[model samples]
Target: MSVFNSSRLAGKTVLITGASAGIGAATAVLFARAGSNIVLAARRVDTLKAVAEHCTAAHKQSGVQAGGKFAVVQLDVADKKQVAGLFDQIPAELKDIDILVNNAGFVLGVEKIGDIAESDVEAMFAVNVLGLISVTQLLVRHFKAKNSGHVINLGSVAGREPYANGGIYCATKHAVKSFTGSLIRELVNTKIRVSEVQPGMVETEFSIVRFRGDKSAADKVYEGLQPLVAEDVAEEIVWVASRPPHVNIAEVFVMPVNQASAGISYREPKV
Candidate 1:
């Protein structure tokens, strides 16, 4: 038998943004294995479809009750039109989403604000901050009507403290932190739960995406020390989402054993 009774997760639906890769992808898999119907959305249709397929397989093998669902949507969260149309496209069976993971975020160019390209700054804000809020605005309506649901925003250690050359990205994450906090307060007195997960130095395609597929540049980041993997953060999200309805996990700061803070790390020399 699967770890969870199918009935426990039967009607629970989880919608994950940035589900094409990294923490988002890993979260989709974990939630599926635990029996939540999944809706995977990302700009990369090919990769997103792969993740959606994994969710279907994971749920099927994990004993999700009859009619439990899995779906994929080609979504560019930064696009107002796309975000606006997203929920409308969701299948009826998965309409009452139980969880929304605002995990679509990225960083581009490790350069000071002055040296940063205009496009990079705009991209970061569009996807990391406004994009998150846009999705939340739409979903909160559904959640509020029921007065029950969980919203998990993927923040970063940078959000807690700004780093050199990552000013714009950090600023955007800070916005996420602020937005999530305000949202929590705004939704107070309702059973709607809101949480943020701030992770430090997770070794995922994050670096690759940040550097635009420059593998060597990305590899240099963790050459000396072990960093947290996508799955590590995914486990934390699963724990947060699984908490009792009345117990809202407000925030989680996850870091690798070798990492003490956002910028502090103990790395082996020449490793």
Candidate 2:
């Protein structure tokens, strides 16, 4: 149950986006335990440091000889220039990333496509779609040069099954899913691998962001259900990246037992 006794990541470097909180943070820690050097990117420098500490502590406990180092970068994936600059600063040792997790994203208030604010739509695309694509392009170039790497893109069930009030968010994730398929096709003969993880409903800051800090509203989203936690999704990501290079799990969809699809889940009455 402690961080020590975990599998050694063994000489792999992983660069994760949106790692300041939620799934990104959880995945960073998991990779750290596997002994992978962690390069965390996020907008919050303080939060990034906290995450790095968790990774470092876990590394020490694991007795894996510190297979890799931990580094943090304040990055806003939404900006093209910032994303480019972040990649350029990859530490020499960690430059050859074994894995890249594109986990930066946000959700505005739910609304019909026609009722969605243009700003919300633009922001979502900027981070979810443009940002994810930009980071992948840069990493692909790196992987192509190195002749090996794994890319794990975070998507949502909403991407696969559109929801009434989730128009814009669904649209962005749908783009990600499509891009993952196309990009993998383009790299068919290369050593680089592309994959996407589509999660149904998980308890995290997602609904908080969607409701703009409406705790009551966010709580309701996960009420009466054992929703997926951040680590649950992160575990899948780490496992996919840990697989042999010869085997690339292209797509993985995770959901809570009570949930079957996007926004379709069994809910019990509050006791």
Candidate 3:
């Protein structure tokens, strides 16, 4: 039986990076609904605040406010110092965090590998790979000391299969896949649980960022069929975190039915 039960997360504290929008925002709300106190962190303070309010409103509606907790922090995960500082602030608000969702990542520019600028590739690694490693390691150190915690790394299907023009982005995600697997093996005997959630072609600001605000280019990624929504990914995060203490879901990849693989997909417009 799957140990993904809501009651498993009751009274737990969860710190989610990139909670301002996209998959991170969705997971924050889902975790809040499941009775976990939420620490929402993102680069945009206003956006984070709005997400927190939404979670609070949902908790109020369901009569889950008894112990429901939420807070927002403006953070840029790329900064190692800031990442460590943000983790320090977690304990003061909701005590020790039982879950850490390292979902703060973005792709700057999308181009064929040969056409890509050197700086763009560097930025991709700066945020996607290095930032993720720093944040996860910081949390692992904290959790290892206490001997308990769940780390969820947000990866992409592109990690498994490289696409035509998204080489750097795919490389970063591939690193996440490898790093997540390695972390799980290294901490296999410990109480800390590390899991990776790989999502494919979600309708969000992801493509816009990749194309540098080129709406037309961004639209091309989801031209046909119903793409995965942020809420869909968020629900998976909550489920993975809700698993029984003894159960650890190492990796979960969520993609639309139309998306059979990273590069191959059934598009509506026949692009």
Q: Each candidate's TM vs. the true structure?
A: 0.95, 0.95, 0.94
Candidate 3 or 2, higher lDDT? 2
lDDT of 3 by residue, 1-271 (tens): 3224667777789889889989998888777776788899888999999999988876676565444788787788888889878755664758588899999999877578688899998888988999899888888988999999999999989888888777888899999999999999999899999898999879988888888889999888788778999988888888888877888888888889999997778877664
Clashing pairs in 3: none
Q: Between candidates 1 and 3, which one is better according to TM-score?
A: 1
User: How many collisions per candidate?
Assistant: 0, 3, 0
- Compared with the true structure, model 1 gives a TM-score of 0.95
lDDT of 1: 0.88
lDDT of 2 by residue, 1-271 (tens): 5333235357788899999999999999888877889899989989999999998987787677756498888888888899788767777777778789999998999788788889999999999999999999888888999888889999989889998898889999999999999989999999888889999887888899999999999998888889999999998888788776778889999999999988678999867
TM-score of 3: 0.94
**What overall lDDT goes with each candidate model?**
0.88, 0.87, 0.85
lDDT of 3: 0.85
lDDT of 2 at 156: 88
- Per-residue lDDT tens digits for candidate 1, residues 94-180, read 888989999999999798868999999999999999999999999999899999999999999999998897999999999999999
- For model 3 the local lDDT of residue 213 reads 89
| lDDT for residue 113 in candidate 1, whole number 0-100 | 69
RMSD of each: 1.9, 2.1, 2.3
Model 1, position 176: C-alpha lDDT score: 94
